[model samples]
Target: MNTYSDLRLNLFCQSLLQSVGMNKENSLVVADSLIKANLEGVDSHGISRLPIYAKRFGDNRINIKPNIQMTKKSSSVLMVDGDNGLGHVVSYQAILNGIEMAKQNGVTAIAVKNSNHFGTASYFCQLACEQNLACIVLTNSPPGIAPWGGKDAFFGTNPIAFGFPTGNDQPVIIDLSTSVVARGKIILAAKQGNHIPDGWALDRDGHPTNDAEEALKGSLLPLGGAKGSALALAVEILTGLLTGAAFGPNVKNIYDNEESGKANVGHFFILMDIEKFMNLNTFFESIINLLNEMKEVPKIPGIDEIRYPGERRKRDKERRLQEGIQLPPSVEEELIKLAGQYNVEFPIPIPPLKANSIVSN
Candidate 1:
């Protein structure tokens, strides 16, 4: 394992994306999103996924130069065609369009089609929240979870994220996948040659399995069985069906190079100006008071604390910003491989570990 300051990791990600022919602005968006995931302790959506991204880029599955175009469907609705571009670039642009539209129209709904796998859904929602808006973000990916009472994979770990301001620089964020866990965690476990805990997924034969590789070949378990499946279906409908992108089994697997053209993933974003309902200050103050009330609640014995959805993430971000990110040995090796493949130097040089070092692994 190795450690790197956020700045160094950000630079490495940016340079790697640029090497794959992404424009500077697009690369920065991707880099920041990935690093933000790492900083917020969502390693499943962080730089660990970059190796696969590089592979897709090398295979020419991702458009080197995307011309993202948006069409207005109504006063408050927009549709974006990603042109097979990186999902981060496409989604960022779509959110930017939504934010601007929301500023004028109180609320905006943006649907994106023909995109690749974007990093974290919260990253986009949080972006809207940072602009003093309330946001809901949804995305669909390659099929990973099976339908209820079925063995075939049909739904991606379709995630939904919600974010809103709380009178602070950091907004309260809630992000969850319909699946028990994001598929990326399974992929990461497989890359590290580790087995997952039981009940997380079923094997190719539909039997419960702890092997990450088998889980990848099989299907992930839904978060709450049938109920989770239903939520996943809702996300699939909004992000894929409604957006006119490939849904269910029609979406190509990101790891399967033989599947054909682009991944054709889809994302849906809803941004609303906070001032639409009430004054921003009043809304934020209400949120803060509620949070405080929750924190002051009586606790069950043996529990240290009860934190909000975004509290831990905010703490993680601050600590990581000061202490840097730690990458597992397997992930570091993958990064090295990508650096060699792209003929780009790894941005951060590892330093000898010290007791008082800011970054170490």
Candidate 2:
């Protein structure tokens, strides 16, 4: 296993992005987002996705110097054109605009189009939580899941995320994909030559399979059968259809090397100023009380603690900050190869592995 401090990882990622012609500011934002995902223990959205991003940038599928623009449709409604930029850069700009608009108008809705894979929705939602605001974020991805009872793929994993100020430093965050699991997890499993759990995905013929590689060649199962499909449909409507971006089968998978044209991904965000609804201090105090009450509830059998959504993530982040982020050897090797190809120096020092932990390719 390879371990890295957050600062070194961020700098390495930024250097790679810069070497590929991304502006300093955009590179910094994207790198920070990726590192944050790693810190939070969301490996699927972390540095594992870096090689694909680099390939896209080299292939001209993602624009390095994008002219991202915002259009104000109303006092509280806005639209952003990403100009084929990396989704991290584009979505970050949109969220910033949404936060400002919400502060001025008490609420705001911002939609983005022509983007390419943003790391994760929770990253932006947490940004709003930091400002003492409530946020909901939805994004449409490449079609990788089928609708209810359908064999062929027609919907993206389509994640939804929400964040609320918890009256404390750590906000309540809920982030989930409508699919049974995030597609990136399957991608990681494939990279590691591991098998997925049963019922997570289907083979190309629509039969469930535990093989990650087969799942990749097929479609992912929805979270709750028909219900998850419905939620994914709603996200598609808001993110892709409403935003005039590609939806359903029209969206291009990020890993498709032979696919031509831009990704044209879409994202939708809703932000609310908590202070506008009631006194901020009072609201926070009430939340804290409710959280305490929930904690007092009896635990189920064999359960040690009742954690709220995002608690585990917060804990993981704290531990990783004090310790270091761990990377699979394959991921580290890919990063090293990417650095060499781009003429960027690998910033993190790799430690010699002990016996029995070496991963075979």
Candidate 3:
């Protein structure tokens, strides 16, 4: 189960969700959203999160049949309430609404309250680029990162994602957590017994700690020291505060606590029609030409070929589609249990784990 070809993985996801009583249509959408993270090399937010979803569902903490409602809707701006539905499904619907608004008004801003973690922010922003639009998205999570010089966490480890259309190439999409390390990274380290590099987080005493367990109990560091903390504060206003959703420590540990309340996580989506700013083709062509020239700069020894922010993930997605995806053993085991509970057949492995029995990353 750790390794599965693209088609096989898709089928497995469908079967697993189906066993949980999700209809085939809903299962496929959820599966695609989760597996797309694996294909993009963001395993931290990939199918490994299935256990979390299962726990929530078992506890009745999530309304499997969410009543998605629009709190406010307009030509250029909108607001929604997720009613604690699955994050990916809610996010997809909201973002699609924003995309349509952009078509009419040349730009749109959509915010949603009372949602759960929606995996990667990039997943939503990239949609705009596919439609020849520029996108800027932000999401607010449970507070796990602290502002500089602060002992307690104040702002969510907010992420800012941007996707710009490019000429004859994948869109230039930049998605990053504002913290020195995203909580997902901490989860990854804990799973793999990997020690984090310096500056990622601190223990409860405000002291730096490489221990993944300690970091999880403590707080993540902010990016750029104070500057990133400031930006995170701004993001809180745009996404959480603006939407009247959970803001700081109140939104803690939605992943592990079955008794916990709905996360009430919030997200903001902004899309600008390319034609509103400039000729879409010209804008993209100029950027591509600039990058082409920049790459020709005299090489420095030891540096790998310079690539844009989204290049590596794009390449990985393409490679993995044919070769298959690899998950950690523990993650694989977790997935299998879900498959068994669902009474779904397991899929065949392709490019399975190496002989070492560890993720061959």
Candidate 4:
């Protein structure tokens, strides 16, 4: 394992992306999104993804220079065509547009099509929250989970996220995948030759498996069995079918090298300007009061504290900023290889600290 400061990782990622023909601005946007995930302790969606993304860029699967187009459909609705661009670039532009539209109107709904896999959904939600806008984000990926009572994979993990601004406090952000676990975590496990816990997925033969590789070749279980499947179906409809992007098994797998086509992933965002509905201060007070009351409720034995959704993530980011992000050895090796291939310099690993260095101090 190796640790690296966020700044070094950011520079390394930006250089690699630029080598693959991405613009400087777009590279920074993508790198920032990935690093933010790491800072928030979501390592599965962090720079571990860059190697695959760079491979896709080299294969011409992702468009580095995309002709993104936005169409205003109604007073509070819009559509975006990503032109097969990187998902981070596409979604960043979409959220910015949505935030502006929500400011003008009370709310805005933006649907994006022809984008590749975006990193974490929370990244975009944070962007909206920074602008003092509440937002709901949804995106569909290649098939990973099966429909209820089905053996074949038919739905993506299909994450959904919501963010609410709290004036002086950190915005309340909630993000979750419909699957029992994010497919990326399984992929990371496979890469590191680790076993997953049971009940997370089934083998290709429809039997439960702890092997990450088998799980990848099979189907992921839904978050809450049938109910999670139903929610995933709804996300597929909004992000895939409604957006005119590929859906179900038709969405191409990001890791499949044999199938050479764009991913055509879709994302949907709803942003609301807090002031439009109620006084911002009043809304903040109400939300804080509700959170405080919830926290004051009785707790089970051995429980320390009850925290709101985004509180832990905020703390994780602060800690990681001081300690640096750690990368698994396998992921580090792959990143080093990518750096060599791209003719860019990989960031030096942070030196490990020596114990008892302050003896007799």
Question: Could you give the candidate ranking by TM-score, starting with the highest?
Answer: 4, 1, 2, 3
In candidate 2, stretches whose alpha carbon ends up further than 4 angstroms from where it belongs are 350-361
Which ten residues in a row are the worst by lDDT in model 3?
352-361
Error of 3 at 272 (Å): 0.6
Model 1 regions more than 4 Å off: 349-356, 359-361
lDDT of 1 by residue, 48-71 (tens): 888888888878888868899999
Over 207-257, each residue of candidate 4 has an lDDT whose tens digit, in order, gives 999999999999999999999999999999999988889888888887998
Give a tens-digit lDDT track for model 2, residues 1-361. 7677778888889999989888899898999889999989999999889899988888888888889999999999999999998999999999898899999999999989999899889999889999999999999999888999987788999999999998676888999999999999999999988999998999999999999999988999999999999999999999998998889988888787778998899999999999999999999999888888998899999999888888999998887776678888888899999999999998654354521232211
Clashes of each: 0, 0, 0, 0
Provide the overall lDDT of each model, using Cα atoms, as 2-decimal numbers: 0.89, 0.90, 0.80, 0.91
Indicate the TM-score of model 4: 0.97
Q: What would you estimate as the lDDT of candidate 2? A: 0.90
lDDT of 2 at 29: 92
In angstroms, the error of model 4 at 348 is 1.1
After superposing candidate 3 on the true structure, give the runs of residues whose Cα lies further than 4 Å from its correct spot: 351-361
What residue pairs clash in candidate 2, if any at all?
none
